[model samples]
Target: MPLKLYKRGKVWWISGTVHGQAVRESTRTHDKEVAEAIRVKKEAGLVSDHVFGPKATRTFAQAVESYLKAGGDARFIGGLDDGLLCHFYDTPLKDIQQNDLDDAARKLYPTAQPETRNRQCYTPFVAVWNHAVKNGWADVRQWSRPKKPKGTNVVRITKRRAGTFPVEYEHAARFIAAMSPGPAMLMTTLFYTGMRPIELFALEAGEVNVTGRWISLYKTKTGEPRGIPMHEFLVPIFTSLLKRPGLDKEPRLFRTPRGEPYEQIATDEEGRGGGGLKSAINGARRRSGIKDIAPYTGRHSCSTGLVVAGVHPHIKDQILGHAADDMSRHYTHVPQAPLIEAINKLPVPDAWHALPWLEDPLAWSGRLAEGTGRRTDLEKRREA
Candidate 1:
């Protein structure tokens, strides 16, 4: 129930009550001044808890659920914390050790598909445990350091796919142009502006500023409200889509053909539980002859496009609601004029035009509509 501060080797240490039990951690600062400051902060946190009555005892699992629930609404990628928290929830926080974690990781490979298991389970384990230690809920010294199995070919096969999707803007434009009012605008907005799919989908009509050429996004991955300038190409598209004769009634910017908002697409019906953005991206990719594209790819495409066109990495990060001030990345924000000009300079190649498949509306509808299969008729004609 008491908090203590001391020095071990060169590192400053802080230890105190976590759910009325002792928990301790190194501040990881070798500098005496910095360590003292951190120790002060730790003591202050403990004092705050003492005055506030411990702010409800949250287990590792409970914290993860809370983090995800609050974070899920954010427009940014919620990192590895969610899954790790889930694993902690499934396994006892105190019982998990480095060896056990390694064993769990090894089991993921060969037995349960290691790569899938590592991403789905292992990485998150490291993250949430780290979270637990940082938040003073557990002693970092007690957690076991799970070692990588020697001679195990930890081939990181799931490497990030390299090279930007250069043709995304053009393909996006064509698909947007081809799309019946509702989806066209949604896709166009994603293509031009680098807003996360959730951020865009989460948009209410009021957040959009057609006259001012910017959109205000309240909930972002960084937990900060950011305003990004609208792409000039998108202004007309949004204005038309927003005020389109029959479309103005819906409060949301995008909806299904049947007039369902993107969020409400989940009707709890069979085979259509919560595809949301996935369904739309698959539909667009099938027609565009672009294989393996996901809805988030639009965001990636826009981000990379900006990067390629000489927009500052920090600005793109800011626009996408990324933590641009992450000193580790050493990024500098591109000024507004240069950033806008750079974005305008993106090369949106007409790659989809080369593929004749997307010309038909039936091919573009998510999951082939009936009587839309060209191969079936071709086989019949050949037989005849």
Candidate 2:
């Protein structure tokens, strides 16, 4: 018999026979709308394969549980889970084919200005299907994704390393100044040091050697602890934050308004989880009237400033934590004095004023919006 939905108390349940064996389960929902969706998914999953016969059928949720449990990097695993499960909840592992996935991609963030479908959508959906097939929990014909159409841009954000561009120093100074204390400090820190936003997020009070005037990152994206000499400009910021009452030597160096640690690159289930720090930058950008400024804009600018200030290439690597401590190669260790001196030489725009959220962001926003904003290839876009 085909699957049938029957009420159990106030909720609903499904029962059916697959390959001559009776299977039954609760929809666990009181609402008609939710129950109907669950009913469809259960029915699809339980139907004995007319072709393959009694092969086991796995629900999308079951496959996802397996994937999350077999963890590697938490961010990648969590990202895939969180991004995919909402779209495919209670879906039958076998029902979705490649064409369906392609259709689903079209609907996500369709109205986004750049038209990038959520690229993260790819992992959970694909990974779950593969895991199910590998484990004998599901058997379905392999499905291949269709070719991406022209002009549909999707950026899959993993842990960030490099940045796309530098915000002009004049624009940066004005933008940072208009932000609140927490974000203004963050923005300045990013610009002066080529630290990845995640690196900053993972920083702690104890890691900062106040007496030695260096910061040690015991946790980093590359699974290595790195030490960076603190810039004189950053000293006051760290000092002020560390002095917050009841904050211990080991507390997170940077925090949000609630005193929770700021977002880090990626820790094993700690910090802001990823988006909080970026959100702060975007929020500050709106208030500062700066267009196209982001958290990463500072890192790019900082590196550029070092290059412009004639810092040696090898020394720059150490300061930015990009140097590899490889076994076979001899690497020159950069000392504190020159690195600090080089950072002090890094240029700041003449327009820097006090960072107190004093400027009207709308004024700067308006100026940019009035055709002063960076334009794409207008002629090429018109042709497209």
Candidate 3:
């Protein structure tokens, strides 16, 4: 084939075979004339390489090393990725066919949810391979990254209700009312801010700005700096928490439940991730007998509450550190008044409308739990 010229994301590229292996490269030009010139040169090079031996092909392992050397691991989130790449470690990128990629996926993620396999396996595999492609070793057009393994028709919506239970605003209020001071405060922050558990743990006292009416943050899993405006109600809470004795000791802001690092409960009982926040949430859920309650439910509850209350989506994204424009919104200077106003519009759940008080949302703690919500006496009796 006369080296096939294609455009990907505005950059023109030439695709063809060199020594029986697929190779493609960006022409770095928008003008078709310029692209055509680049394609001709690439085709000439491909012919030369085909007649002789082609450039040395890189293994998937070397691609991973290049990626890591470029500090890619810090940029994306995933574990068990190295194991996925191990399947093709020794094989040359040029020799890797779609079948080889498929076999790896089927073996490593056979019975894992297709989405899980895609993210945990194929996602990393492509990232590693892309590093090679950028260096003129592999091809994106050849063996494509499998976003979902073959024959997996359904994108299972069994969207894990795992490790968390939803909390309505009133239920949150009651849960807070019933909880110890430390847990109460912690849950309150989660409920209002929709901040992640790790972000909560990473909060420094200096990050909170009562005078500026915003909380600036840099320590996030996304590795992006954020400036979340403080809600009106949270100002007093922040003021109180900021002034509490021994606040200066830890680098992080609110060491609620005092002295213990947030991850202790996560480590001992609740398992890794979310740290003591997860344990504290579960403990409070049990203490209050609030079904399906966990730390993350607080974030969702806050988001749902805002949405239901007719708050602007952009405002919600801003408050929760979610950029609708995906990091671009982070840089746009939005006035605090509008943010606070949108927050004020977020309706608190009435006493009669509170969950657990009114109803139980689903609970899928991911640990093969019983039924979802509350069951009646006759229903329970029938099961017995």
Candidate 4:
């Protein structure tokens, strides 16, 4: 039987059988003409699916829905779907070719850097397409991604580097000293542990073991659980912060002055995920006169420091949670001595000792702590 349109209250609905499959759904419109059009399209699609198989009828939008239902990370995929949907919404999954993807990338991000285009466009597209492939909705195919120009090692000195800027320990100490206790401790932890900002924001008080001198991260960007050895310099800082009166019952280790968890994660329209510390970090950078520094600077600085200090590549990779071995990841009893030794090699500048938070972290607890007294000499001079 052909699908027939009927009125259910004020809304139009369709019910009947097409291609021997039962179909009953709301057209979700009050207009009879629109409802009739929907019913016809539905009947046609059913007939095509029955004749050509599901792959021929399935759309990219449908595959995206299935991918999301299967627990795909929606941060980037959700935010960036408008352009993708505009290009491929009604297009059959089987009909989407490599050239179509390439055209989509160019049309979506005409002026974006190659890296940005790859990250925002190609990565998410491949992820959804691969998910469809796994479910037998599409054939397996590799989509080409934009690549950076090959390095020739000809000393090309650019004012600004392409990636995360690595701040020196001296500048880092100055920057941390300029902020209040809450943000200062957060930045310090990032530098020492080399953990991603998202991971630090999600850190629970229970995961931090001061006595063991190791912080356990159950969730990471890579979806692997691993441990980070706390630097000796961080020992007193964490010890002080953890011993605060009500922290024993608190779920999150890091919190704002108002005693709320840091906003953890925020997604921009471009589908980038940033930590909640943007304002605090910007304020600190301005005060310290370090225009180039960002929250990710601490992570980059940690990696640079490890390399400069002659830490082994394997040990550095493990500490930075980058492509670690299966044994190191699975074996809970793996020794922490190597990680600890590598982390401790990161330099601690003498200028950090002068920061009041280094001695008494709780002193800068309130909103008032961000006053003139906490400002660096450069900040003070600007005010004067």
Candidates' C-alpha lDDT: 0.53, 0.59, 0.60, 0.75
lDDT of 2 by residue, 1-384 (tens): 776778889998877775565868787889867887887766665554443532345556677787656541234333333445656666676676676676666555455333234323454466666667767767756555434456649655544332356756777887765454465666677788777777787676677765555776656554455667677766666766666655564477666534556754442211134446655555555655665666767777877878887889877887787775753123222236766777776666655544322133211211211121352222232356
| Runs in model 4 lying further than 4 Å from the true structure | 1-81, 85-100, 125-144, 151-163, 245-249, 266-274, 324-326, 332-335, 367-384
Q: Can you rank all candidates by lDDT, best first?
A: 4, 3, 2, 1
Give the per-residue lDDT digits (tens) of candidate 1, residues 177-202.
33343454565566677766556666
Pairs that clash in candidate 3:
165-292, 203-253, 262-276
State how far residue 3 of model 1 sits from its true place (Å): 26
lDDT of 3 by residue, 1-384 (tens): 567888898888888875566777788888899999878766775676566433344666667777777644422222345465556776777787778777887887788766556656666676676666767776665445555445668554554453243456766676554444455566667777777766777787878888766777766544456767666666666776676555677656555444444542211111235565555555556656764556666677777878887888887887777773455445434337776676665455553233221121111111111221242332343366
Give model 1's TM-score versus the native structure: 0.55
> lDDT (0-100) at residue 249 of candidate 3?
78
Residue 327, model 4: Cα distance from true site in angstroms: 3.7
Model 4 lDDT at residue 134:
73
Give the range where candidate 1 is weakest over 10 consecutive residues by summed lDDT: 264-273
lDDT of 4 by residue, 1-384 (tens): 999988999999999998789998999999999999999988998898899988888998888888777655555454334667667888999888889988988988898877778877888888888888877788888678887777786454546631266878997888777776687788788888888877887888777887878888875655567888889988887777676667666667777655677766733322135455666766766667766666677788899999999998888888888855677777433448878888999988887767665666654443323453454433443356
Please list the residue runs of candidate 2 whose C-alpha ends up more than 4 Å from where it truly belongs after superposition. Answer: 1-73, 76-163, 265-274, 326-335, 350-353, 356-384
How do the candidates rank by TM-score, highest first?
Answer: 4, 3, 1, 2
